[model samples]
Structure formats: structure tokens, C-alpha cells
Target: MDFTDHVVVGVDGSSTSIAAAVWARDIARAGHWPLGIVYTQGMAPDVREMLGEGGTLMCVESTLAPALVQASRTAAMVVMASRGQGSTVLPIVDAAAEAVLQEAAGPVVVLPYTTWNTLDRPLVLGLDAERPSPASIRFAVSVAGRTGARLKVIVDDKGQGPDRARLQTVQVLTRVLGSDLPETFDVEVSAHELTDALLAKASEASLTVVGSQHARRSTERERSENRLLLRLSTSPVAVVANTVEAGQADGSATR
Candidate 1:
């Protein structure tokens, strides 16, 4: 259960699952972390061959959601396909992925089947100007540092001036990241809705990170927006659990 230095991915033999495995492999390779594969249904032999040697394989008896939830406890990050083999619909995340997003204890990356090649692209962080999550910020910074990608922080604010937006973002970043902030980073404040802003930027990003208050029940609107981004974003979407307390900096601005 201790996967602190591993990039864990859930595989179900679907094309999307295979793609998620590949993405996890690349991330593990970049960070010099081991790759852990968890299979609840079953894993394809081809997937094993594709991954090659030295990856840990886990076969769980429970469902995908429970297995992933347990793995997320100490895993560096848990990766899953937006939709599995049971789903044929477009623009909708599968049940297991949605459940994991709502309950996973750590960061979860949901990769859609249409995920674009993200090499050398910027890492997009969708920040809530009002209530930024420290956990989200640290994860984004760590990933950007490992991949040598520019960290682009997108803040969704209506009626706020660009200068004010930048100031607020900087204050939050400084408070959370301190001297660990990436050397190359920029802030973008948009008046558009959070989903719209992230969608526009995701087209050119390697990965888009959003904070969610997974410890508590999320509003229906919040769930809808997260699903929309997971379904339509051009890149893999990381749903990091916001550890901030409720009512005070709950990190809902990006939700």
C-alpha cells in the first residue's frame, strides 16, 4: 500500500487504459519513480509486454474504485482512464473514474482516449484565486520541476483586473510554495468560467491540474464542471484533493 515513490495506474485492458499506462510510464521514467499497475478486472498480455520489465503488478479483488482509493493513500499519484471498456459514450467519465475522483485521498490523473501528445508542453494549473490549495500547488510545482515544463497558473476571476489577479496568485503561490516555486512560470487571469478557461488552455498543455475538496461532499455544479473538463480537455486532467478546511479557503474557485 505504500507507493510513495511510484506512479500507480489502474488498467482494464481498454485502449484508454493502455494509454493511461503509457502516460504513467513516461511520468515515472521522468521522475525516476517505479511504475505500479493495479488491475481489478484483468490486464492484457500486450500491456505487460508494452510496459517491459521492472514494473510492479497488483491484482485486487475489489472493484476499481475501491482499489484505486486504497492505492491513492500513499501513491505519488494515481492514474486512470476517463472511460473504461464498459463505456462507449463520449464526453462522459466512467463510473469508476468519477467515484475515484470524489473519494481518492491523493492526486488522481484521468486521461481521456483522445489525449494529445504532451511532451515539452506547459503544465497547466487551474487555481482558485479566492482559496488556493497548498497540496495542489506543491503537486503542480513538483511535476513541472520534474518534466522541465513551464508552470502556467490559470485563475478564473470575473470583473477583477489583471494586475489584481496576478497579485493574488503570487501571494498564494509564495505562501504555499515558498522558495520551491519553479524558475519559469506565469499567471493568467481570465474572466471566463473555470471550465472554459481551463479548456482553452488545456489544448496546449501537457497536463491540467484542478483542486477538489474530496474529503467532503461536492456541489452538483462542481461535479459537473469536473466531469466536463475530464471529458473534453485536450490533455490529461489531474484532480488533486484540496486539503484546505471548509468555509476558509476551501479551494472551490477552480472546482
Candidate 2:
């Protein structure tokens, strides 16, 4: 199915979910696309009023993961709160969010309960120089272009020289973006761990994007890293799946 029509957000009547819905609404509005709110049960009247029009509300009998996965099949992207409904005192990624991130056909955005103070910050991207995903790079550039936001690409050196890491990043970006690169973007090679570097960058960013390989299932280490990133990121984190397989050429942007 073509995935370029609507922005779908999963809500559970919680304030966190409502915040995510509002974020999704703004994205839909900006892109001139329709918005979809998927919930399992009844939603509050005030919440519905806040969301307003140019969207559809869908109630699914199943759990949040299945509902979001079904909606993501045709959506440009799927969004959800980092923690929802029965969250505990300790901050952790909700089960449903984790499941959807792993199984969703398209990108999955996880919004934290804490709201960002401003929208002028750059769009941060955590890129792996050794195994860069063209889909992720294209998605970040597309969002940066549409929002008129600067793009900050972060790469971990992993003991390599900063110059070499930056060079690798530039090569991958040039190949992926070609002439369609964002007007303002810079590559930052960090010596710290990937998760730590992203956390620091996300604190001052409007949004942070990372890539997840589209596979049968994620390894334990990958799952742990994803959970850590989602649990601590100060801004909304977008986990874009690398739809293009290894040894295959990159295709057009899905969004």
C-alpha cells in the first residue's frame, strides 16, 4: 500500500497521549495531510475538541500495538507517547510503543511527556557511519526541508579519528541526498557513546531521528539501545525503519 496520506497517532486518554496527538496534529497540518487518532476506548470530549477537524478518530477493540500497526500500513508515520496509561514512577518505554516501533511498516515517533519549550531548534539525526541507512537520511532531510529547520547529523567515532568519521558521514549523505540536501546541515563526530551523544543532542533539538533495520526481529542489544534512547530523550524520537534492504539501491522517499 502507498504510505503517503495521513499522520496516525495512538492515544489512550492519558495526558501524555494527548500531547502526542497534538504533536501529530501539528505535523499533519504542516504537511497538508489528514490526521488519524486511534484509541481503544472512549476519548474525552475536551481532548477531541483540542484535536479539532481535518482528521478521523478510530476505536479499535484490540490492543494499542495491533491498532497502531494496522494504521501504519497506509500512514506516512505513526506516533505514540513514550509512556502511557499505567506508567510507574521510574521512566521507561511503554510496552505498546516498543512493540509498534519493532513491527510498524513505517516510521514510529515516540513523544515524551515533557514538552519542548521551543520549535526553533535543529532536527537531530543519529547516523551510523559504518552502516548508514539511506531511508533514514532521506527522511531526516525531507523533514528538515519541510520545516525549514537546520539538520544536525551526529556520528560516533568509535575510536576512529574525527576527520575520518566526518568524511564517512559526508560520503554517505552525499550519496543518499545527492542534490536534494537540506540547505543547512552539519556533521558532528562524537567520541562518546551513540546513546549518550544522542541524549545530549536531543535535549536541544526539536526532534531526534534514528534508524532501525527492517528485519524479522531486533537483537537484544538493539532493543536495549532503543529502549534507552526512548526513555531518556528530551525531545520526540523518530525511529525510521530502513525499508531498503542490504545490497539494494536506495529508492524514493516514502513520506
TM-score of 2: 0.87
Model 2 segments more than 4 A misplaced: 1-4, 220-222, 244-255
For each of the candidates, the C-alpha root-mean-square deviation to the true structure, in angstroms, is 5.1, 3.6
| Residue 186 CA displacement from its true place in model 1, Å | 1.3
Q: lDDT values of the candidates?
A: 0.76, 0.74
lDDT of 1 at 107: 80
Off by over 4 Å in 1: 40-44, 216-222, 244-255
- Specify the highest-lDDT model's number: 1
Model 1 per-residue lDDT tens digits across residues 7-59:
78988777888899999999877656678888764564666798998688887
For candidate 2, lDDT tens digit of each residue in 12-58?
87788888988888866654567788876767455578887666877
